[model samples]
Target: MRDNEKDLSWWQTFKSVGAAFFGVQSSTNHKQDFNKGKPVQFILVGLVAVILFVMSLVLAVTFVMPA
Candidate 1:
């Protein structure tokens, strides 16, 4: 670990993953995430985010195009 780097909390990991989902993560944050973020944590959060995103889309479509 570098002198200024610290372990990322779950919230931080989620925010980082969210920013990545939007393709808007800053370079500084990206670097920090690589340095301090755990790969497993990121992967777990990313999976959950993807599931939620897909579910939201399904719900929106069902609502908009009723049977």
Candidate 2:
């Protein structure tokens, strides 16, 4: 919506996405090792996803809910 760059830089967001991407990428590459930590990784990802979802939902409701 607003300018892509403001207080935060693109690199910051990109790095976060990259970190998550690598976690998934390596998980696939080393399935055996990944399995050992799969539960932890899954829980971390799920928690992050849920938090993001909840925040977005709250923002949307605030903007779109009936007065």
Candidate 2, residues 15-43: lDDT per residue as tens digits?
Answer: 33445645654444344333333344455
Instruction: Give the least accurate 10-residue stretch of model 2, judged by summed lDDT.
Output: 5-14
RMSD of each: 1.4, 13.3
lDDT of 2 at 36: 31
lDDT of 1 by residue, 1-67 (tens): 8778679999999999999999999999999898899999999999999999999999999999959
* TM-score, prediction 2: 0.42
Output the number of the lDDT-best candidate: 1
TM-score for each prediction?
0.92, 0.42
In terms of lDDT, model 2 sits at 0.52
